[model samples]
Target chain A: MDKRLALILSEVFRLKEKEINIALTKADVGSWDSLKQMDLVLTLEREYNILLTIPDILRMVSVAGIVDVLREKGVALED
Target chain B: MVALVTGGGKGLGLVIAEHLLSNGATVVVVDRDRDALDALPTSVFGKCLDVTQPEEARTVVASVVKEHGRIDVLVNNAGVIYNEPLVNIMKPEGIMHDYGRFREAVTVNLDSVFIMTCAVVEQMVLLRTKGVIVNISSISACGNEGQTAYAAAKAGVNAMTVTWSKELGRCGIRCNAVAPGFIGTESTHQALSVDSIKHILQNTPLGRLGKAQEVAQAVATVIENEFINGVILDVNGGLVI
Candidate 1:
């Protein structure tokens, strides 16, 4: 879960792997705007081939929440 | 009063050339179609030149300047359109889709604008001539389906307008763009019926198609309004919300 969350965060926010922290939230990253959130959702859908609902997207307000949604969608998260 | 308009042989370019010529500005109509160039009125100095070629642009601008002694306005109006879903786009399947057509569209639509503008601007700056450059952009620039390359290219034009407005502002050259929505041109009317037009109109606030002259009027306003620079005027009747 930590590794997958870090990878997604790094790719979506264009940050280095070392720069991403599991505790990061919307307020923690300046790049986490509404547009970037939409882009993140789209990227996750395309990369994992999982159709996310509006509720799922809205619930993913933090890195841990994104991992929770991915787990709910049956995506295997590497610890 | 010399002015150069690429693709001035037909469509919006033809209307803009006529408007400028009617205002007593000597016009040079550049197009790849010699027949179309010949079809222009005698008042216009027509030349068959493919603007994609940088050398050709320089040569034509020089010829127009030699004959008219000055270039007061330049309108980069030549463009092409394509419709294909981004994912299903064949024939140059790659990162950007339709790589061949994408390359050609970028060259003709975006690069040619840069080539012509640079060529004309060099002369304008050397002669210390204050002039106007109006790039014809599309509402698709905002983001539309089946227009990945076209959108990127037109967006490039919009960005260039802003950058050039600052770079050449000191030289008294104003750069601006016009983003037109779906207008009821001959081609558009043929492609779309009254019912389809109504759909677009329903989406648009004005509830009708736009005339080419309306777009020309917007361009003319940009040209006449000296203070107006780095502006991407929406002549779409508020279609783009």
Candidate 2:
């Protein structure tokens, strides 16, 4: 897992790095409810200094999905 | 620039639309009055919309985004004013007031402002476009006799203007409001008679009613000045001061 991505995931969902996976989704994670989804959005925005619209939010459903969108935004997840 | 002015079909709204158009923005004006929409020039796009409906608010924002690609500014100028003393508003027998009128006043003035601003700002955030929102509030926001609904709603507008500015400013968006005092418009004419206008002017320090153009200029100033945020610029000829 990319270190920054793991950091955000852990901070947003209060999870350990070992528990997270690319396939992990809001449905799979008990803490990833709607409110959590919004919180994650704000957290991602604050961390990345990027803005996501409703459509962008709808597309980012899972950890892998978030990684993909972050890549599209040119965020350096590896560091 | 792309701008949307609610209640653009008539009165001050119309003037605001014209000002934006003249300033080189692709202006979209929405109003519930079909006749008012028809009155707009061919150069401007006019939509007959009742913004109080959440669905309509969504659709308008979506279409504006699709067609214009971005909304640079939003002027929430769609509103109405009605005045009837509380005593006359107890229902069933009051000659001066009706509950329906109060509901309509708030719905049009305040509720629509809330719905439309949220819809527009959502898209603005998504686009990552720095935008400006100017809400049309009123001096009655401070409070006025027989204007409970109008006062509450306009005051709500001012409050939201400040709140959104703080919340969204980090996203490169700014929210501000314009509170006009006795602007000359068809709506004003409907709300007050000549004698009432005269009395208001007499009490006003400036000794005159404000013009819609003055209000439009204040709105434009807030929109242009990037550093200004969360301000309720009054265009009332220093009435309250």
Candidate 3:
């Protein structure tokens, strides 16, 4: 996982860096509510300097899904 | 802070804009009247656009963002106080209130707020700008007599203010409305007859009409207070009606 992506998720959801994993989904995080989702989307947009569509935003329900969406948007998300 | 005020070319809106400017905000005033827009102070950035049109609102909002980087606050003060009885018993013909005028009042009072808020909020969300929206409502929202359309529109404005505050709070956006009572403004005096003004004064606890600056102060208070959200604050002088 990209260090920046992991750090953003950790900061946005107020979780430990080690807690961020590809297997983690929004349902697993108690703090991943609508507000947190907006924060995540904003943080990701700022970090990647990319605009996300509604579909892309909705598809980012899990870490793996977020990775896939970023990849589809031409974001390498490499370490 | 960059503040955009609609219908800010004259009356109470101008007062609010100037007050915001005095408070160190870069103020942008938009009005439909070119003459009024031109009459604004040089320090204010005046743009002539009808706020009721969604397309025009979007275009103006985009231009404002382009010029000022982002809008930190939006004051939806572009509205007309349309006074018409539901039915005029003395009229010989067409006694009922004109439907066309009612629609126009709604369009100007309620639709402008919705349209401008949509455009500004879209920009704020996309830019991730933490912003405040201050909608200028009126005491008439509580169902003022002889102002069916105006009252209905202001009530709608109050509803939108609450709804947007709940929806946008997560986005770090606050929505609030300042409902002013009868103020000693040119428009207010022009709208109400001498007897009507006397009646209002007698009923008001303060025994006088409100000043525009007081309403401006209320607006500034809501804008400055970070914790305030979805509040339909009344700037009236203890006048319920």
Candidate 4:
């Protein structure tokens, strides 16, 4: 699940796989603007088959942040 | 199966309603024009409705479900167009259109679709029927001359098609859109001059305008195909890339 989420984030933000740092928030990534944030939210929701609330979507700012949300939704992730 | 078509009074909407009915699905048609609704065949279930009226959408949706067990298909095909560019063509001193025209374009084309879809989808969820929605877009969705408002609304339909498919897929409902080019409908025949029509044909790869039946075939195909989801199927005859 982590691998899939990372890939989707990388693709949406147009970042190289190696450049997709867990600490890189939307403020850090040049491409992760508000519009791309919405795209990421939609993509993540579709990819994981989870419905995200507006608050959850707004809080999604980085890879670690996404992993936390997915985990809350009971999405099993690789250790 | 049961289906509902907006703007089924005339032009392409009428053809789509007939096509679905002929394919063994019962149909309910709604239109703002009383005259157009009256002209339909006696067998068709017709309603003279102005969808823009706030309460009409919910009332019509409820009535259709009450009469029919369920609506398995919905075609959001109601729309209007004004071929006025950003700059005034009719009067050089004024702008292309007043604020009212712009509001009317978005209201009729975009708002009506959103309202009707929500109303139908709510019932579909309650009944737990796997429903299908097909939105009729236009080639102008990409961009077209004198279609500032129409293009925006059609493009909004395309976006909703994709968004709804994702959001509603869990409920077993699927959504798609069809963007058509110039079609030889009664409205098109009356709107464009012979010389302008000739120019359009010359530019079209098929060397002729599309028939309404041809578009009906595409809409029916989408409804029949279970695998196609979140697709903006272009029925244009290669007019644009």
lDDT of each: 0.82, 0.85, 0.92, 0.83
lDDT by residue (B50-154, candidate 1, tens digit) is: 989999899989888888887889999988765444543112224235578778878888999999999899899988999988899988888765577778889
Q: Indicate whether candidate 1 or candidate 2 has the larger DockQ.
A: 1
Candidate 4 lDDT (Cα, 0 to 1): 0.83
TM-score of each: 0.72, 0.72, 0.75, 0.73
User: What is the lDDT for B174 in model 3?
Assistant: 99
* Model 3 chain A weakest lDDT span, ten residues long: A30-39
Report the Cα lDDT for residue A28, model 1: 75
* Candidate 3 clashes between residue pairs 3 or more apart in a chain or in different chains: none
Tell me the TM-score that candidate 2 gets on chain A alone. Answer: 0.89
Q: Native contact fraction of candidate 3?
A: 0.00
TM-score of chain A of each: 0.88, 0.89, 0.94, 0.88
Model 4 residue B49 distance off true place after TM-score fit, in angstroms: 1.3
Q: Tens digits of per-residue lDDT for model 3 on B1-241?
A: 9999999999999999999999999999999999998899999999999998999889999999999999999999999989887864334356578999999999999999999999999999999999999999999999987899999999999999999999999999999999999999999988986656877898999999999999999999999999999999998899878
Relative to the real complex, the DockQ score for model 4 comes to: 0.01
Q: lDDT by residue for model 2 over A1-79, one digit each (tens)?
A: 7887787898888788877788888677765644456678888889999987666677777988888888888788762
Tens-digit per-residue lDDT, A1-79, candidate 3: 7888899899998789999999999888866654567678889899888888777777888999999998888898874
Model 4's CAPRI class is: incorrect
Please identify model 4 stretches exceeding 4 Å from their true place.
Answer: A1-79, B89-93
Residue-by-residue lDDT tens digits, candidate 4, B78-143: 988655556542242453466688789988989888988988999999999999999999888887
Itemize residue pairs with steric clashes in candidate 2: none
